[model samples]
Target: MHLSNQGLLVILVVGVVAGWLAGRVMAGGGFGLIGDLLVGLVGAFIGDWLMPQLGIHLGVGIVALIINAFIGAVVLLLILRLIGGGFGGRRRWI
Candidate 1:
């Protein structure tokens, strides 16, 4: 399919916002512009798929989209941390 310019813009904005929000909440700060955008975009995909599986729907709208992405981003960050990616670089023993 084809996506309009406006649609693409909206996706970028949402990804940035969601990524920043998740970084701040999980990492206690933003992960720069590019980092935030990447995290958000990947998170958006996770949220879009995981949300429905867990029976969690935030309705429809820009706000809902952001919420979904934010949730997904948080989850992503948490997973990364558990795997010792950004969790103080400490190796977990368990």
Candidate 2:
């Protein structure tokens, strides 16, 4: 399905938020705005595919999309860590 400009924007925003949330939950921090957005978009796609195969359904609407994206992002981060290439390590604070 093709999303309109507005729809795409909404999805992107949701992805950014979901990715940031996931990063914080898994990595103790985010990988910055662009990184989070990228992770979120990929996570959204992953969630869209993985959830069904795992016998999980999040229903429709933006909220569901966020939840799906968040779950997927967390999984993605975990996988990346297991592969020894995730955005790990603590952030430096001055």
Candidate 3:
């Protein structure tokens, strides 16, 4: 969706926080600012795509957005872990 400047800022901040949290949960620490930001941004895309297929509708609002992004980030991390591959790897899954 198209976000205004303020909305984008909010997403950035939320995504950073959510990514950091996911990193901590998965890797035992934060992935640094840039790493976290990337994860969060990608997570937003994942959530936007996956949530609908899963029949999970969080609706709108800042809280829903944050929740969606955070959940997606965590799922991405988990998938990465299970696949035992880094982002540079051509095959992320076995």
Best by TM-score: 1
- Against the reference, the lDDT scores of all candidates come to 0.91, 0.88, 0.82
Whole-model lDDT, model 1: 0.91
Clashing pairs in 1: none
Q: Across residues 1-94, which tens digit of lDDT does each residue of candidate 2 receive?
A: 8879999899889889999999889845788999999989999988989999999998999999999999998888888887875555654577
Per-residue CA lDDT of model 1 for 64-90, tens digit only, reads 999999999999899887786675445
Candidate 2's TM-score: 0.86
Q: Model 3, range 50-89, lDDT digits (tens) per residue? A: 9999999999987788788888898988887779764442
Which residue pairs show backbone clashes in model 2?
Answer: none
Prediction 2 global C-alpha lDDT: 0.88
| Model 1 ranges off by over 4 Å | 85-94
TM-score list, all predictions: 0.88, 0.86, 0.77
Q: Candidate 1, residue 89: CA error in Å?
A: 7.8
Best by lDDT: 1
Residue 89's C-alpha lDDT in candidate 3? 28
90 in model 2: Cα distance from truth in Å?
A: 7.4
lDDT of 2 at 48: 89
